[model samples]
Target: MHFTAEQRLDGGVLERTFTLGEIPGILWTPASTSAPVPLILLGHPPLGLRTMYPRLVDRARRAAADGFAAATIELPGSGDRPRWAAAEQARADLRRAVAAGGPVDDHVVDALVLPLVEKSVPEWQAALDALLSLPEIGGPVGYSGGVISIGIRLAVVEPRISAAVLFAGSLVPAVLFEEARRVTVPLHVLLQWDDEGNDRRAALDLFDAFGSEEKTLHATMGGHTGVPQFAGESAARFLARHLK
Candidate 1:
């Protein structure tokens, strides 16, 4: 891993941009301290880092203020990375189905999300390896935000993540429901009750499927991107309860 840039943000947070192999990523650390801080992996949609920067930085800063280090890596076929033709086609199909105002076909959801889960989970694991090697970042780790499916996969496969805050803002393919049953870490799931892009019933079912002995589903009344500030504070408290 190689860092390409570094800057200081308000509140004594240090922000650095880096690349691991071909994947671009960003890391934010709180003010210098003698002890290494617990890390939060800030998960986001495949919406390219440039498009998602404002929100990602905001979340990172919050984590910093809460005495944690945060980091995020671009997903496969997203940001400045090379694109996949099959995924592109799957996206087009999904759009067409949504525009038609009919139920999205099972095949379309599988095509679009399954491959993404298959490719991106390993990349996130690799990023965790590099981030943990840094002097300023340490474990036990927490993962916050989504694609919710990716978070589910990570929770099941990446044992280093002690807790997770998953946003139910995207459609989860059926296969991941089984994986959800394998997630044994504590989870805080956020759901936007009026999300236009997600299936509310499926989101609830997914939450019910989690095998974790401790899991909370925090649902709020809003559309996607309308999560209240207090909701984030609640999530931070949940992470602190476990990661700290």
Candidate 2:
């Protein structure tokens, strides 16, 4: 139950890591705590490439300072101690496959796609379940990620997450959209204006399908990576509004 400090921040940021089920994450919490607070389950990009993404780490620290328990989870196949062999290479291969055929053209990439998806989903679900069980977290939680954000949308249906922040990820295969409709929580999707690969229109279609009246769509100037900084303040505001 003890966590190892991973980083130090200004204004009393304390970083630690916790093993939740089979997954582990670096958590940033404020030094001063008076009571139990809501939690944010931050899903980092695939392959742990963004483990050192400064904006993301800063956001977690700010969330802690703002009085929410925030943690950045290194997904099943994405941490330094990944469960899979050559995890980054495997992820890169899949990305190449997706890019070759376009996001919606699953027929061209299902051979490589299915197994990777299956391998990663369970670990995400376990992380979500563990976060909800923590005394510091309330019923509703906020999720954010790039491509892995799609996986989070798929896994979060049953537990009923309160609010979700999806960045540059899509709900493809139509069936995934059906699952997304089951999420009654507020969903804020951020995408680039000219994202040719992921197709901003696809994200719009998914937003149209969302069941919540509180759903929002914001378009920024840059591609995938641009979202974290563009939407950082908005993300903080959204979490503040809904996580409480």
**Candidate that scores best on TM-score:** 1
What is every candidate's alpha-carbon RMSD to the true fold? 1.0, 3.4
Give the Å shift of residue 20 in candidate 1.
Answer: 0.2
Per-residue lDDT of 11-57 in model 2, one digit per residue for the tens? 77777777655455666667776666677767655546355557667
Off by over 4 Å in 2: 83-104, 108-117, 128-139, 148-156, 228-230
- What is the overall TM-score of model 2 with all chains considered together? 0.80
Alpha carbon lDDT of residue 54, candidate 1? 98
- Give candidate 1 misplaced runs (Cα > 4 Å): none
Candidate 1 per-residue C-alpha lDDT over 20-114 given as tens digits, one digit per residue, 9 for 90 to 100: 99899999998775799999999998899999999999999888888899999999889899999999999999999999988899889889999
Clashing pairs in 2: none
Residue 135 CA displacement from its true place in model 1, Å: 1.7
